[model samples]
Target: MAEFFNSISRRKFLLTAGASAGTVLLAGCLGNPPEDVGGNAAAPTTAQPVANISSEQAPETTAVKLGYVPIVEAAPLIIAKEKGFFAKYGMNDVELSKQASWGSARDNVEIGAAAGGIDGGQWQMPMAHLITEGVITKGNKPIPMYLLAQLITHGNGIAIADKWQGKGVDLKLSSALVSQVKADGKGGSRFKAAHTFPNVNQDFWMRYWLAAGGVDPDNDIDLLPVPSAQTVANMKTGTMDAFSTGDPWPYRIVKDKVGYMAALTADIWKNHPEEYLAIRADWVDKNPKATKAILKGIMEAQQWCDNFDNRQEMANILSQRQYFNIPVDILIDPLMGKYDMGNGRKIDDRTMAPLYWKDEKGSVSYPYKSHDLWFITESVRWGFLPQDYITNNAAKAKALIDKVNREDIWKEAATEAGIPAADIPTNTSRGVEEFFDGVKFDPEKPEEYLRSLKIKKANV
Candidate 1:
């Protein structure tokens, strides 16, 4: 049995009187999915048939409006909708609706239970963890959330403008970035860097990148909150020195011939889980069969996304205005892992691509509890959540992790979808992971990891 759910239950997590009454009243709000829910049901996109008729594939809730922000990271969920995977598995009424921003996506889901407009979406993993801890609340009440699975990994980057491009700012290799920043500081220049949002994947990775190079992210660099879509424009206008953000943005800069990728976040940590499908716990509780169906379809889409042959076409499909809205040409290099750093250097390698399925490290989609603990640890380090995110330290952290990991649901859905047991992680961890700067994040010593950080907020 899932111990976290056993201890708290879904009702206690979401329905604490305030959020409950409104959600109960708006329970019948879902109408349909997005406009792309139609088309060939048997189009044979990439993933082969994984399930034979089984009770596990049966969906309870037929319609759901999952929110999204335009980025290629939303690929798996989009593919599940476009390729008819959702329809094939009985969720014929799935819509991949667009949200205005990351914060918007969060609010949409937090109020989803009461408003009943949005059921789930590809969201930041750490933010979901924060919601569970009651840090990211609605009406001062904890909004219960469940991360069913990870959407994409490493489809993001850190990039710099023309000002620092040829000045040698490459992060992966030894560069003069630190020296340049120090010189600039002495010369009365303040270096600024931006990322998508605070307390999320991009923020953590960007800070980790800057800190690794002996620069205090908070104290040394003037950090800016540049949205992913506007990152390139801001960089072009010299709004910030550089940025850490999702795909197409990084690639868009290089395509515009004004900037270059400093480092792909994947190079920081391969197979790192980025965004996750944060579903309201109330939605998951009410739609058990439907939830599994959604997971199976997404798992299959993930498998399809991991397929080597499908990547090129997938990138092209993601470029449509309905999705990422970037041109197909710019997305190809990033999506295909054909990186051009724009510093007279080019890399034609697959390691940096935002892989979906199993690579040498292991499956990228597994919702490992270890990943959760690491996210929580980072969230605390950055003041995104309270230092005492849990009252009992590691024990409380583990309990919160157990509450939201949902690997059991992932394994069950994967198995029902005819996926191999090997793909499903038996252990909660991917072992002790080492970042690009050689800092080891051992999930067991989360509190110790928090203490080891050089740059952190006042509260933590």
Candidate 2:
């Protein structure tokens, strides 16, 4: 994976140069300077149609340093640029920087303090921790974060190496593989699974999937923390046996025929909130207008990506060396809702390609409070936080969670962007409306849900 990334990096450098030349020509024709083509620009007060906007209206942040990785799920960011959504919204100066790892992206956002950073999935729990603990920014100061918007949901999957083939481990075929792991003695076949971070969405789904299958993730297997970009190679080299990560990685494994997608994380929790556009709390507080403008640009990008016609274009951009660096064939399957699992399982469900604002009304409905509670429960279940910590520090934790005003921020931005406010989800306690098997989540009672589970819980 590292080698692949290195090759991708070089390819992106060349592509960036080439793309820059084209941007220059386009800028000249538009009577806009090249410098305003990519970074921070002045914010706009009123909404504007993406198609009619000009570079002169572009925000001053052109050299805007936005961080992202090369995953199929991150199509909105790619589409926004490819389809000129950002340019339409006056984000003409936006520049994308492909970070080496998720950690790198998060760290860069913290240190560089750019406009915002993209998360592989809804990492509300970890982001909450970051705010309270001051690990990334000052804790007491509390970096106010905003959910610019959701990229897509249900695009992530879990892949197990080919060695596990014929072991009847197919996710669609059965949950027998999970049972086998449970039957394995202490450490459960010593299976190793990698995730980008402990607090991200993959971690939540990975742990929940195991527990749902009657396996205690913390005890049944060894969970290794690895960057999402390295998951595939780690599995190939035997450093790990399975991994739950976002698109292109798992899809790449299937393409290589070296691994089989054991389960789609979306299957574990369909329509699950995947990635989010998170910015420093302070940044939002200080640049409310600018923040809204950025959100407008991102919202436009999300709309462009949700259009079926744009899938091919999105895949093409991500396949370029400057972005995902993977073959377009590998990237397109998951993005287009066509799945070819190496184990002879094929899926054509549109559910696979979760979009940001597809429904406009349904997609951006409500911020599921249950989603946040689920992560908190998982943190406790996994010992990332002490049992008493949640209870004793309930006030602090709640304050941290409250700092992420998804409802207010999303509503305001969506309204400003001409997205109907009625479309926003009104029930904050319901985390996700649907799970893989059609289970609904009620975030209001996360503790009860956790206590009902048979999985092992550390005595705290």
Off by over 4 Å in 1: 1-52, 55-57, 113-116, 172-187, 390-393, 457-460
Best by the TM-score measure: 1
Clashes of each: 3, 31
Return the number of clashes found in candidate 2. 31
Q: What is the RMSD of candidate 1?
A: 7.9
**Against the true structure, what is each candidate's TM-score?**
0.85, 0.78
Counting only residues 3 or more apart in sequence or on different chains, how many pairs clash (N, Cα, C under 3 Å) in candidate 1? Answer: 3
lDDT of 1 by residue, 186-213 (tens): 6557888877766577788888888777
1-460 per-residue lDDT for model 2 (tens digits): 2233233322321111111111111120122112222221211122334445344433445334455655655566655555566666666655666655554454445555333443122232355345434443322334445545566666788888888788765554347766677677364457676666654567777776666665677766777666555656676787777777778777778877668888887667656666666665555565565565567667777777777786765665556545555566776668778888777778897656656665422573235545555666666666555565356434544655676645567666677667765566665554444455434444554454446556747453
Off by over 4 Å in 2: 1-63, 114-125, 128-132, 135-144, 172-189, 359-361, 364-367, 388-397, 427-440, 456-460
